[model samples]
Target: MLINLWYVAEWSKTVKDKPVKAKVLGQNLVLFRDLEGNVKCTADVCLHRGGSLSNGWVNKKRDCVVCPYHGWEYNGEGKCTKIPSEGDDFKVPPRFKVDAYPVEERYGMIWVFMGDLDEKDRYPIPPLPEYDDPNFRGLETEFTWQAEASRVVENGIDIAHASFVHPVFGYPDTAEDNYIESIEKHEEWAVSHNVMYPPQLKGGFLGWRKLIRKDKQPTVVHPGWYLNGMTVKIQIDLRKDWKIVMFDANTPVDEHTTRTFAWQFRSFMKSPLFDKGSLKRLSTILHEDAQIVEASQPYYLPETLANEVSVKSDKFMSTFRMARRRCIEELGWQIDLDKRDSYNGKKVLTIPSPGRKEALAEGRGWVFETMPLVAPVKTPTEKKDFEKQVDELTVDQLNSKDNVIG
Candidate 1:
């Protein structure tokens, strides 16, 4: 998993009066709301005796989370405020703190920056204009997939799969008619517009749903991906004034697990009575996707496309891969999974936070070691060579054999 990106740790409603446990990018985290009702996140491990802060409780003042094992009170900023054993007169050292992350509550989710980058350098969170728009009624749900996050994200943006997987989306006979209309790319995100001839909507009260769209109707779809939160957004224009938008934030619970926080919004269905069918259809789509993604070979996404064959239809997904790979190799944001796994049970390693970065700059030491990152390309010549290699890889992808079997 890549570091230095914003990730949805939990639903905002989930973290309230008590500390809640969350895991992202393989590291455990503790989330709680302070006295001011602001959400705060920090490494779950306490410096004293390796106790779990999440297993503890918010103190009486509601300003700090008190460790159950030793009564060490850590405030919202992760500074140790009180040590019961040390008595009132004792002052905790400046180094007595845990890694505290920057937290923002948006779109009903708790977004935490899982790296040490300062505020100015971090990419802004993905936008969801439909969240507060009155024209749309949104339903929120979450799903957990037993697969790597990158694989799950690719599946979400792959428009071609709807023909074979989701019956409500398209039909195999009309698959040839589906084509990408245009693609707009950015440094951290991209959006692709596609036109598809799909079958009619399946479910509705009685036979009224047939009026929405007939069989083989031309549909317009916009699929987008954002690096922040590992998000995927698909907007379907059912008609001029009718639309359905799905925004999903895929969080890497670990190397092999992904948790998706999803929101489905429909412009036509503004009443609560229609929500049941909308949610049921969304659930069906997710299950269909999980069946294929979980069973795919090569558990993690390939670092290169050498082992995979990609046709023109997969170019959008390739953009995501290329951007992620840049972060891994050029920016050195990828965690060294092998090194981390080696110290699995014996050592405690935390993702570096803004607090950790500040402490280190001042020559203060941390109790736990920081997670290891893959080495980045360091020299100017090496960067030029890497870019040339990427260009070659992209060129090689265009020569894919259509008849090749998976």
Candidate 2:
């Protein structure tokens, strides 16, 4: 994961008056809303005895989070305000604080700055203009993948795979048919447009019936720029009056882990009842993509185009990979080549660390590099239990941020 970027920590409703745990870019953070209802995020570790603050509670009156172990209270600013062990008259040193991260509440998600707070504004979160349109309605879903963030984002944007991996979105008959009209790549972002003849379900209920029984559709796919960045969008026409957009906010939990929050926005179906069915179908389609992505090779992404084969239909995907490579090679972001064994293709376990940021003087530019250690995964024996895998999308991820498994 890169620094100076915004990553979804948790959905807004998930972080209410209670401290909630989330991990982004390998940082364990606790989120809670203050008295004013503004969200605040900080390192989950207690400054004193290394206790977890997520195991704590919110002090409603003081608008602070109280540590469960010793009742140490820290406010939104991350300043230690009260130490129950100390007498009321004892002055809590101003220097006693936890690492506070910048946070924003947008699109029903709580986003946190996973880098230097000063750099947050430079890389703004992707805007959703459709959200402001009264006629548009949507729902959000979250999923965790045992794959790298780059691979997960690539899966969402890949046009060719729709035919093979996602049967619901692409017909098996048109699996060999491919089309890509145009692609544009910028310094910070990139856009690719493709002409697609998608395969739809032949006969089904409301929306599905309309799509399949109608004329064989040739649609356009307008994908957002900067494929490897925090946001990815796929705008495709579902019908003349109704268009569907799948906007994904991809976050790296660690080197080989990802958190994806997708917003399925449709301009035509404004009814909430209809949207519920759409979300279920969309969630299932995305899960199909996940199964294939988790099985990809060279987990950290191949170093160059030479590392993998490509064709004409892969133009947009290739561009995204090129831009991502530039950031890793030219810019400071790097991949941990040593973490994976060359002979056996096995990943070694190591304690994960956050990315480091390097900046030029006078705000010229900056680069964030991976710290190189793989995030720790608990062996199943350690916990003596494995949580049941929930295939359906839920308010929270199928796997809560707290549980770790081998």
Candidate 3:
């Protein structure tokens, strides 16, 4: 896994005046908001006694983090500002400091770099689509589950598992052949996987309903990584108003745990009743997927030894692993030499394209230059007109048809 790149630590709203602990790619970090309202990430270990800084409280007056065990206070720059037992005239040791990482806030999330400060800007966070659209309503949710970071990510790109492990949560009824259209790599910082979800059995009650209405849809899954690690961004585009959902899973805890953040963007609804009902339905579906992911045992595996055979649907996963290996090598991260040799035996694996050099150079500050900003289709004019009427409709009229009762 690539280190020193920014990974989403928590939703921006969740980090307030309190301190929280986040682990990025196996590095434990203490995150807190200073009195000035700036977020910071520092090595969780106290310099004096190795006590976890996360166990301490934020001192608003001096804008420092006060270690609970020894009264050692550390500022945002990781320098010790106060040592309670020492006399005012006593000089603090020059080495009395904790390591700090660069942090930034965007898209309602806090992203932290987990490596040397000199390499901070080399890898950037990937840009998101929802940030620019006002009509898009964003709903964010988090899930804490026991799983390895790689396994959790592989699950996100595994289109075939939907029919089996997540059949009820709007996964297509049948597994259809899919292929990797293209893969964009960013050195050790990130990889963008573009997968085409071909027309298949649109399962789920919602699918049946759409079928009754003579609507058919195709989906594309765009998964990306940021901050040189396994944090995953999954964007799904369904053709209707309530069709798109974006999921960002940050493995900020460790190899055995993950903090999954999901965001749903629904186009303006014509009816408040429909909006509320849609939220509930989507939330339930997400929870179902969570349950399955949480239940998988031994979530992390050496990909070289995976018993599963690859098919057309697995192209993205296979390509992702190849890109990940190249990144690990490029960043000089440690690798199991045996596994490297084994993977080399298979000719199907290949390194990421060199074209990624330009994109990776743009890094974290890359702006979106493409359009169809919202889905290409505009809402029906009649539907927009009906929005006000539906808003004013009686409860009886709204509840006359129950989309959830099924």
Give, for candidate 1, the lowest lDDT window spanning 10 residues.
Answer: 386-395
Model 1: per-residue Cα lDDT over 7-57, one tens digit each: 999999999899999999999999999889999999998999989999999
Model 3, residue 186: displacement in angstroms?
Answer: 4.6
Per-model root-mean-square deviation over C-alphas: 3.5, 12.3, 16.4
- State the TM-score for model 3: 0.68
lDDT of 2 at 13: 85
The order by descending lDDT is 1, 2, 3
Give the Cα RMSD of candidate 2.
12.3
Instruction: Please tell me which model should have the higher TM-score, number 2 or number 3.
Output: 2
Residue 63 of candidate 3: its Cα lDDT? Answer: 77
lDDT against the true structure, per candidate, is: 0.88, 0.66, 0.55
lDDT of 3 by residue, 162-231 (tens): 5565543223643553434555544332343443443433434465534422222345556655433355
Q: What lDDT tens digits, residue by residue, belong to model 2 across residues 95-163?
A: 566666678888888888765435523467777777667767877887788998888877777888887
Model 2: lDDT to the true structure: 0.66
Q: What is the full ranking by TM-score, best candidate first? A: 1, 2, 3
Winning model by lDDT: 1
